[model samples]
Target: MAPNSSAPHTPERPGTPVIPGFAHRRVEVAEGVALHAAVGGAGRPIVLLHGFPQTHLMWRHVAADLAADHTVICPDLRGYGASDKPAATGPAVYAKRTMAADVVALARALGHERFALAGHDRGALVAFRAGLDHPGAISHLACLDVLPTPDMWDVLHGRDAAVGFHLYLMAQPPGLPERLIAADADAFFGHFLDLWAEDPAAVPPAVRAAYLEACRNAVPSIVADYRASATVDADDDLADRAAGNRLRMPVTVLQQDWGAALGYDAAGLWRAWAPDLRHATVDCGHFMAEEAPGRVAAELRWLLAR
Candidate 1:
């Protein structure tokens, strides 16, 4: 469905940091669901998806820079930020497959049938799925600081898996995860915001507060999003893997030396899924878009060139 002008406009929270000139919009991508996005720039379009515990604002620096030439879109994935968080009535609702379709629908609703796609953290999972499921719709793909779902599960075992303990925490069946997270939403979500960034000041106080606020209000949907990953999302990836589905477009992956720390070849895993791939290790932390926006933007420009 196309964007519904009738859909209520979602106002930015007061003092919420924004991409200088980007406009906020609420675009309905499915029945009773609309994604909140910050859209700006004006040329070939590229959509940027945010990761866990962060919103479109995470792309503020990169989006503004990209807007100089390319139309840049940064959206709160359905369950995050100000986006509508319909109850996860079933598994598919919060699955990356569904979120991937939401991205494609969002772009089309804004008048582009095909556009480049990039995602960070959880968003990267969605972009990965989008590239596999809607190969013709996504012109280029860039993933930051994450592994594919099945590979992510495969890599974690023994003491090494402790780094991702939250994955196990949130993946539990519904009630307990939601209750535990909501009990101290800030502490739960803020833990990642604090731990993931190499430069803590990169996120600053105001933006961090915004993220915490968003996560606090959307705990259930957030857990549902993660829960979907542990179940349906992994199932989807397994099916894709068995069928040998690969991303057909030019793909770029940027990450810190996770392979060294996690005891896996990150690039090799990405190469199995993306035949046309360029994988590099960055010197910064997980929040590379915030910590090193210039390099992230440059890499995206390179991907667009291909």
Candidate 2:
């Protein structure tokens, strides 16, 4: 299905507007799946995908800065924010392959056959899949604060694995995880915002509230998305590895030195998957885009230049 071209290019939700100078619209990427995207500027197109527990609003600062010289497109990934949260028919539904397809179709709907792609956290997983699956569609790729699913699983062993407890929690068969999170959604979701941020104040009150609300309302879909990561997503990554498939485009990764903490060579692991790779460790916490937008934007520019 083509994007709803008739959909007004304005913020779909009245209470929470997108970044200033940007317009919001819902683009139908697949049947029964439409993504809410905030678009601005005009040059080479760059799609920004937000991480977990946050909406496209997380890109407010970075998007605004990039908008000056590039068409900045920020979309809340499927099952996130205002996007359609279809009930999971199977684990494959929320696989990164499906999510990546949603992004490719979204860019094409906006008249961009090939564009730069960047994703933070969960969105980074989708961007990784896009680079591997749709290399011809994504001209460049940048992933913020995440490793590939296979690498991620390989590195988790002791205390380091516990740090990602949420991964194991959501990876469970689903019903219990959904129930537990639903019981106290705000606190559960807010824990990451508080724990993973270098500066909690980096996320404004209004923006934080928006994230909480989005997560609270989409508990089931969110859990299902994570569950897919453990099963189908992991399988896809392993299959690619077995086939000796690597990302074809120039890839840049910005992560918060998980290797230093977990005692693994994060860069080396990434190098195996991306032959043309630029991996750097950032000083900020998980939410690097929020804590260090300037640095994130600089890295993105470098990726695009490469």
Candidate 3:
């Protein structure tokens, strides 16, 4: 279920420290739920959506530079950072549809009728869905280290699916994985923070600890999100494919070149989905924003220019 915009913004979960030039705000989109957002810079808003485990802080280095020329808005995706985590609604609200609504609403709340977008990991999924679902509202899009939700599952089926064991495990009977993850929050959440990071040391100790704690705190909502992917999300993508609607806006994609293992035609796949597409692989891990902020910023600049 969606939250009420009239509800107070209460502190629910821990958040990464707001860096310099960035000011954090809590905005109510629905009746009772408010999203925690960080804003900085000026002109032509460029919103940053973070991946799993990490909050908007993941875009700190990148957002800092973009802040100079672009109004940077970074939000803790619903249920992840300080955002509302109401009782998980039906599979639809947790669906990327709902998540994208949170982003669209967040931008509108911040006076952004149009903006550029960049998302990392789970945020990337949200960005893709938002770009598709609200094509007219977004001007430019950049996705880091992810494929479309349906393509992700379709390509990963059977033998290739083992890479994302979390998906399989999260898809299992809910209470089990949710409880297991919640039980040893630090260990469960920190495992990915350690593994997925190309440079584990890039994230400070305090930051890593904070991210693990947030993941631990939001396990139920997070699991609910992944569970939706197996149900409603799968169906949504099928409908989209059946409709043959591709992104009409300019898109820039950055990935780890998992093409070798995933057997995905990265550029070709994006070309099929986006009308104007620029796709490339980086010599980095899944966490491109954190590992290579300079290169990522450079690519983003190039993408925006195009």
Candidate 4:
């Protein structure tokens, strides 16, 4: 169900931010859907996935730094950024498994059989699934600021769950979430951009405007993506945990100290899934790639060497 080439591409909106050295591409990962990726550099490939409320642009700093050595491919996840927003006909359409498949396909399409992978927030979930479901294709994995879907649900209770209110909102049956979010997409998406950054200046005015614009235009698909996480993605993670499935690749996890606030060991939780894991708590906010690109890039280089 690929889109008609005649249908003018609308995802990469006018005034959308761009990474200076990277070349943008609309690569078809599925029959009908093409992912918008910013690719640059050479040598070994390392695909970087952007998180929620942001696009490949979030990786601008890190991607530029990594591109100096490794080939860095930054794609806006399917339902976000400039990528196709296929209707979520079923949960699988937006499931992490499916998204992971898209990532593998995108890399293979770019001529890389296997690549190191890293993702932030929602993208981390996709990278996690890619590591588990496509173990042979991912050489190394790094997840920033997110836990496995089931572990996330398990760890939140009472007031602690307030931090994830949007998860519950989006988890509800369709209609309402999309309507509510679309009603004030800017405020809804901008809230996180404001709330999650440790250094507000890290996300400059132009980048912030770009993120808001992307989210404003993508309310439905974005909601579907989150909705799948609460249902199918959670089920997938639980099934894997029950079957003792673990990531076979070398793994690195960088997260804020949610453990202290939420009463769960973030590193311990990640270790259960990634046997060879290196988890560290960072001082920055949720947008670590933008907030501390140097540290993030150094950690990635270390992971690549392993």
Candidate 4 local distance difference test against the native: 0.91
lDDT of 2 by residue, 192-304 (tens): 99999989989989899899999999999999999998999999999999999999999999999888888999999999999999999899889999999999999999899
Show pairs that collide, candidate 4.
2-32
| Tens digits of per-residue lDDT for model 4, 125-238 | 999999999999999999999999999999989998999999999999989999999989999999999999999999999999989888998898999999998999999999
* Candidate 1: 10-residue stretch with minimal lDDT: 1-10
Model 3 CA deviation exceeding 4 Å by range: 1-16
Tell me, what's the RMSD of every candidate? 1.4, 1.3, 2.6, 2.4
Candidate 1 lDDT over 1-306, as tens digits, reads: 455432435556677777788888789988888998989999999999999889998999999999999999888999999898999889999999999999998898888899999999999999999999999999999999999999999999999999999999989998998898899899999998888888999999989999999999999999999888899999999999999889999999998999899888999999999999999999988999999999999999999998
> Candidate 3 on 1-306: residue-level lDDT in tens?
354232223334445456577877787766666788888899888889999878888898999999889999888888888887877756776788888888888888778888888898889988988998998888899999988877788678677777799988888766898888888888877878888888987788867876776787799988988887888877887788799988888899999988887776877777778879888889877778888999999998888887
The TM-score of predicted model 3 comes to 0.93
When summed lDDT is taken over every stretch of 10 residues in candidate 3, the lowest stretch is 3-12
Tell how far residue 100 is off in model 3, in angstroms: 0.6
Candidate 2 lDDT for residue 19: 91
Q: How far is candidate 4 from the true structure (C-alpha RMSD, Å)?
A: 2.4
Q: What is the lDDT of residue 242 in candidate 3?
A: 91
* Cα distance off (Å), candidate 3, residue 88: 1.1
lDDT of 2 at 288: 92
Model 3 residue 96 CA deviation in Å: 0.6
